[model samples]
Target: MSYSKPRNDYINAVIIPGYTYDSKILVTQCPLEETVVDFWTMVYDHNSSIVVLLDQLNRKTPLWLGRQEVLQFKDFTIVQDNSPNPEELKLILSHKEKDPMSITVFTTSKVNNDAILPSNVLLDLLKKVTECWKIQKGPITVVCSDGCSKSGIFVALKLILEKMKIDDEIDVFQVVRTMQVRRPEFFTEFDQYEYCYRCIKEYLENDSVYANL
Candidate 1:
C-alpha cells in the first residue's frame, strides 16, 4: 500500500496496552479532538495507521478496525513470547504492507518483569522504528497507553535507538510527554521512568564493551 506524500502535520499511531477492549476508555483522553481534522485526513488519505498491541492476559480475542470500514487500520501482528529471539522479532516487524510508512503493534507479557523486557525485544522495536524513519516521508508518532506498561515499552524503544546511535534524532522527552497527554494516569510511578532511563543508559555505556554472558 502506497502512502500519500508526508506532511509536517502530526500523524499518530495510538497504542492501547493490553488485551481487554475496556482499555479503550483512554482513547477518549487522547488529543484526537484537537487534531481531529489531521487525524481523520491521515486515516482517510491512507497516510496513517493505528497500531495496537494486545497483552497476553486477555482470553478474549482482540478485534481491529478493518480498512474498508474505516480509513486504514491494520491488524496488529501479535508477538507472543516470554523472551522472543531478535531475528524472529525482526522478521515479524518486517511484515508490513508498506515499506516505509507503516505502523507496528507489539504486545508483550508484562511491563515490570526484569526478565521479560530483554535487549533483543528493544532492539527489534528500534530497528522497526528506524526502518520507518528511513522510508517514511514525514514524522511518525507512536501513541501508547495503559499506565506504566506502555511507558516501559517506550523506555525500551528509546534504549534501542540509543544503541543504534540515533538517540539524538528522536526526542525522548517529547515522546514521554505525548504519552502523558494521552493518558494522564500513565507513568504514575517515577521509579518506572527512572528504571527505563537507567536501562537505556546502562545499555549504551556497557553493552559495546562487555562480553555477552
Candidate 2:
C-alpha cells in the first residue's frame, strides 16, 4: 500500500523489484473517475516520476489530464506539460507544500488493455522508456486495465534489460518464475512468454540493441 489512501482498497497497484532504488515499476490499473485522485496520490507517494500507460485512455483519463487545468487532487496540484508526441504526455505535479515533480506518461501502440503487443512494438516502447529513465530517477508506474498481463511482459523485459546492462546475461525462466510468485499470472499468455524469449534473443544477438541495453 502507498502512503496515500492506505486504508482504501481502490486502486489495484503493486511494487515490483528493480535494478535500482528509483528503477522499480509500480504496476496498476487505469484509474476510474473516482479513483483518479488516488492514482496521482499513489504516484506522488511512491515518488514515481514516470507512468507508462500501455493501453488507450478511458474517458476519465483525459479529464484527469485535462490540458491547461491545474486540477487539485487532495493535497496535490497537477499541471500538464507539452506532449512530444500524440502517444505521450508530461505533467508537473505539486504536492501541497512539497517541491513540484515531473511525471511523464508513455503508451504502448496497442489500444486494448490485455493485448499482447508485438515484439517490435514492445521493443520500441523499451527504447522510449530508456529515455524516460534517463530523465527521472524515481520509480516508474505502469498501467494497463487490470495491471498484470501486458504490464507483466513490459516489467519483466525491463528487469531483464536492466540486468543485461550490468551482467550481460540473464536466466529467462528464473526471472519469470520469480515474478510470478509475487504477481500471479504474470505474462498470462503463452505467446507473451515466447515473445519475451524472442526479445531477449534479439537484444543479445544484435550488437546495436545490446549496446544500448
Candidate 3:
C-alpha cells in the first residue's frame, strides 16, 4: 500500500513478509516534518498499535513533542502523555481503550554513526521489548534516523528469540538471511551483524528461560 499525498517513495515503509502468525513489523524512517501526520495515518491505516522509535528528534521543533501538546489532523486526535521521562512519551490516539496507539521513543548510542548498539544494552532492550509486546501486541512500526538500520537489528533479534522460545533452538544465520530477502540491507554492516550474534549468544548463555529456549 503506497501513500499518495506529498508523493514520494520513502513514504512507503517496507513490510517484512512471512509473519502470518504474529504482529506485523514495519520498518520505516523517522517521520519528517511534512510526513508527521502521514506517518500517523500509516499507523492507523495498517492497524499498527505500537510504534518503536529509535532516533533522536529535534527538541524545539513540534515534529510532535512539547511538554504536552495534543495534535489534531484529519481523523486523528493524538494526545501526548509525558511525565517521568519526557523523551519516552506515551501517546493515546482517539479512544481511551481499544484501537488506541502507543509510542515509545528510544535511540541507542553509536560512534560516528557506524557502530551498532552495545550488546549488553541491546539484550536489556530486547527483554523490555518482549515485555511490551506481551502487553500491547502489534504491527509494530520500528523507526530510526535512516529507518531500518538499527530497527532491522531489533527485528532480527525478536524473530530469532521468538522462534527459539517455541522450538528450543534457532539458526541465527538462516533467520537473518530470510530477513534480508524481505528487506534489502537488513543487518548489512559487519559490526552490526556481529553485534546481533553477540546479543543472541549473551541471551542464550545467561538467561535460564531463554537458554532452554
Candidate 4:
C-alpha cells in the first residue's frame, strides 16, 4: 500500500529546551521558510500542530510564541529524584484530556534506564507519531536534544517509515542535516552518529524484508 506524500510545504516548528547556536542554525537552514515557529518557552500554538523541544524537560514551561501570545498546558515533568512506575507515568499523561496530542517529556535518565521504556514502547510511540502525520494535512517536525542518547526517537521514526514501506521517499539526509543544525553537539560524538546510522539501516533492511514477505 502506498501512503500519500507528506505535505512538505507547511511551516516547520522546532522545540528546544534553551537557545543555542546550533538550534539557531537549524531554524535558519530548515527548508520551510514561511512558517518556522520556534518554541523558546513552553507554549503551544493550536494553529501549528507540530511541537519541537530540546528534550522532554521543557514540557511544563509556558509556550510563548510571540509577544503577548501565551499558550499553557498541564505540565508533566519526568520523575528524576525517584523513579515512578510506568503505570504512574501513563496516568500522568492521561490527566490532560484537552491536548489530543500525546505529550511525553523525558530526560537522559530515561535513556539510561533499562526498564523505563521498553523497546516496544518506543516502537509504539514512533508508530503513533507517524500515523498522526499520515492523517494530518501537514508535515511532522520533531525537535529533540542532540546526541546518541537522544537519537533513539529519530531511529524509531525511520523504522516506522521503513515498516510502512515508505523509506525510499523519506529523505534521511535532510533529516540528519536538519538535526545537526539544531544540535551541533550531536555530531561532536562520532559514536552517536554511527549508532544512529546503524540503527536506521538495520531497521530499514529488516522491515523491508518483512514487507516483501
Model 1 regions more than 4 Å off: 1-46, 49-54, 57-61, 64-116, 137-148, 151-182, 206-213
lDDT of 4 at 50: 31
Candidate 4 whole-model C-alpha lDDT, 0 to 1: 0.34
Q: In model 2, how many backbone clashes occur?
A: 0
Which candidate ranks first by TM-score, i.e. highest? 2
**Residue pairs with backbone atoms closer than 3 Å in model 4 (clashes):** 15-52, 15-53, 16-53, 16-54, 42-62, 42-63, 43-63, 54-145
lDDT of 3 by residue, 66-130 (tens): 54687765456677776465534577666322366566543344312445667776666666555
Put the candidates in TM-score order, highest first. Answer: 2, 3, 1, 4
Runs in model 4 lying further than 4 Å from the true structure: 1-46, 50-122, 139-175, 178-186, 205-213
**How accurate locally is residue 132 in candidate 2, as Cα lDDT from 0 to 100?**
69
Q: Which of 3 and 4 is ahead in lDDT? A: 3
How close is every model to the real structure, measured as TM-score? 0.41, 0.85, 0.79, 0.40
Ranked candidates (lDDT, high to low): 2, 3, 1, 4
- The sequence of per-residue lDDT tens digits that candidate 1 reaches over residues 1-213 is 223344344544344332122212112112233343343334334433332232232223222222322222232232223324322221111124433333433344443323335554544444444454444423233333332465445543443344345334535555556556655564567765665666566556765532221
| Candidate 3 TM-score, true structure as reference | 0.79
Backbone clashes in candidate 3 total: 0
| Model 1 clash number | 1
lDDT of each: 0.38, 0.76, 0.67, 0.34
Of models 1 and 2, which has the larger lDDT? 2
Native-to-model Cα distance after best TM-score fit, residue 128 in candidate 2, in Å:
1.7
Can you write out model 2's per-residue Cα lDDT over 70-96, one digit (the tens) per residue?
A: 877666788887665756787888876
Please write out the lDDT profile of model 4 over residues 50-133, one tens digit for every residue.
Answer: 332324333333323222233432332211122253211211121132343333322233433223234434444455544444
